[model samples]
Each structure stands twice: as C-alpha cells, then as structure tokens.
Target: MMVQTGLPPMMAKVLVYLFTSDTEGLTAAELIQRLRVSPASISKAVGYLERLGLIRREREGRRRERYIVLDDIWYRTWSVSARSIQLGAGTAQDGVSVPAPPGSTSPISA
Candidate 1:
C-alpha cells in the first residue's frame, strides 16, 4: 500500500517500523538494517519526508542524524494542503478565465 502511494517499499517499511517502535528516534543505519534497505533509499526517503515536514531530523552527537515522527505531523501536512488550496482558489477568483480545450470544460471554474 505504501509503494502504491509513491513510497518505496523499503522506505514504507522503515516508516512502519518507526511508527511501531517505542524509540522516539532512529538513526539512518538502524533504519536501514531494520528495513533491510539500501542506505541510498533510506537517505532519499528521509530527505523527502524532511522536505514535506512529515518527519524531523535532529543532529545527535558524532555526526549522526536521528529521524523522528512529530505528533502534529498530520496537522502540518493538512495545513500545507489547505494553504495550497486557498492559493489556488484565490488565483481562480482573480479573473483568470478557464482555458477550456476544445469540447472539454476546464476544471478550474471561472
């Protein structure tokens, strides 16, 4: 299901493991071993989630970065989405005519 939702299988597994585990954070190496995925994959997913603000990374001592899931992650995610929708609605309301191609009506209502 996670793979279908645009997450790699290993990345999804790592996230699930983190969600289930009692630890508040996990290092990349620990996640890699637990999920049995390549370092590159873990790094890529971590980067993506960090950018999305779904997960946070804290720099532990000795150059290690620990990843954690925030309790308000969903609130942040939905807020971003809502903000985007507001922007889109505002743009649509700014007299931008819908450019309907041929017979199809444009989804963006004028």
Candidate 2:
C-alpha cells in the first residue's frame, strides 16, 4: 500500500517496521537485521523517510543513531500524500489540451 502511494519498497518496509515494532526505536543495525536488507539499502530508506518528516534520527550515546517514528506519523504521512495529490491535480488542470488536426475519430480529439 505504501509502495502504491509512490514510496519506494525499501523505504516502505523500513517505515512500516519502525511504526509497528514493539521497541521505541531501532538502530541501523537492528533495521538491517530485521528487514534483511543491506546497510546501504537501510541508509537510503532511512534518509528518505527522514527527509519526509515521517521519522527522526536520534543520536544514541556517541556512535549510534536510532530511527524513531514521529508522533502522529499516520497523519503526517497522509498530509504529505494529500499535498502531493493536490499538486498533481493542480498541474493536470493547468495543462493545455491539444486538438486533433483533422478527421480524427478519437472521442476526445476536439
């Protein structure tokens, strides 16, 4: 479902796992182990989610970063998606339709 909404598969997996997990947060190692993905994949997904404001990366001690889902994550994600849809719809409405040259049988040609 998240992928269908235009989120990449890896990011969706990381996000869903983070929100659904029993723990408060998960480190990159933990996410990699649980999701069975490469470090690079987790890094990319984490970066994407962070940029979207769905998740935050907190410094744990001096050497590790834990990724936690932000409060009201569902609402935030929905708002983001809604904004994107609205932007797309606006762009579609602003487009100029080209008419068929002549003698075209297409229903929308005019």
Candidate 3:
C-alpha cells in the first residue's frame, strides 16, 4: 500500500515498522534483525525516510543512531504526498500542448 505512494519497498517497510512500533526508536541493527534485511538496506531505507520527513534519526550519548517516526507521522506523510501531487498538477497545467500526431480525427491539436 505504501509502495504506491512513491516509497521504495524497503523504505515503506521500515517506515511502517517505526510508525507502528511502541518503542521510541530502533537502531539499525535492530531494524535489520527484525526486518531480516541487510545492514546497507536498513541504512538506505532510513536515510530515504529521514529525507522525506517521515522519520527522524536520534543519537544517544555514545550509542548508535536510532530511527523514530515523528509524532505526527501520518500528517507529515500526507502533507508530503499532497505537495507532490500539487507540484505534479501545476506542472501538468503549465505544460505546452503539442499538436496531435498527423491523425485526422483527433481533437488534441495545439
């Protein structure tokens, strides 16, 4: 379901796990262990989620970074998706209309 929203499969999985979990956050090792994915996969997924504003990375005194979902995870996700849709719609509305390809019955001619 989340994959349909432009999130990669791994990223979607990681994000969903973090958002649904009761714990404050999970370290990459823990995520890897729980998700059964490679270390690099978790790293990439978390980085992508963080950049999308869907999750955050926190550090303990001398411990590994943990990834946690923001308090308003759903709202943040919705907002990002809405903004993307808005940008796409604006671009579409601003697009130049091209002449219909030599077909005689088409009404799409610019």
Candidate 4:
C-alpha cells in the first residue's frame, strides 16, 4: 500500500507502529526488532519521518536517540502543508492555475 503511494513499505510500517504504540517513542534498535527490518532500514525510515516533521528525535543522556511521535504530529504536519495548499488554491483561483503543480491540487474545489 505504501509502495503504491510512493513510500517504502518499511517506512509506512514504522509510522503505523509509532502512531499505534502506547509509548510516545521508540529507539531504533527496538524499532528494528519490532518491525523486523535492518538497522539501516530503521535509520532510513526514522530519518524520513523526522524530515517530514511527523516525528521528533530526542537524545538520551549519552545514550541512543529516541524517535517520538509528536502529540499532534498529524495536525502539525497538515497545518504546514495546508498553508501551502491554500496558497496553491488561491493561485488557482486567481487564474494562475499553471503556478500550482498537478500534484498540488486541493481535494476541495475552489
């Protein structure tokens, strides 16, 4: 499913696991064991999610870094992206449809 969405399957799995977990965070080693992915794969997926601002990294005292799903990660992610989408919608409404990329189309009609 994630492959169809142009995301790595492990990355999607990592996200689902994080969001569904009772704990707020997980270490890479734990994620590797739980997800049955390579250490490198865990690192890669964590990096991707961090870059997306869906997760945050916290360093323990002289220990491994932990990746946490922010309390309002989805809200935060969509809040930022929504602004961009709004700008695109405005541009489209202003007869500058070409300024917005095809992928930037809003789900709601302007």
lDDT of each: 0.77, 0.91, 0.86, 0.80
Which of the two, 1 or 3, has more lDDT? 3
Candidate 3 to truth, TM: 0.83
How far off is residue 1 in model 1, in Å?
5.7
RMSD of 2: 3.0
- lDDT digits (tens) for residues 1-110 of candidate 4: 54554456887899888888887788888899998879999988999988878888999769798888888876876675687689888987777443554666654445
Model 2 stretches astray by more than 4 angstroms: 97-110
**In model 4, which regions exceed 4 Å deviation?**
1-7, 80-110
**Which predicted model would earn the best lDDT?**
2
Tens digits of per-residue lDDT for model 3 on 17-88? 887778998889889999999999998999898898888889976978988898888899899999999999
Clashes of each: 0, 0, 0, 0
- What C-alpha lDDT does candidate 2 achieve relative to the native structure? 0.91
Of candidates 3 and 2, the better by lDDT: 2
Candidate 2 collision pairs: none
Q: For model 2, how does the per-residue alpha-carbon lDDT over 71-99 read when each residue is reduced to its tens digit?
A: 99989999999999999988776553545
Worst 10 residues of 2 by lDDT: 92-101
> Which window of ten consecutive residues has the lowest lDDT sum in model 4?
96-105
lDDT score, candidate 4: 0.80
Q: Estimate the TM-score for candidate 2.
A: 0.84
TM-score of 1: 0.65
Q: If both were scored by TM-score, which would come out higher, candidate 3 or candidate 4?
A: 3
User: Total clashes, candidate 4?
Assistant: 0
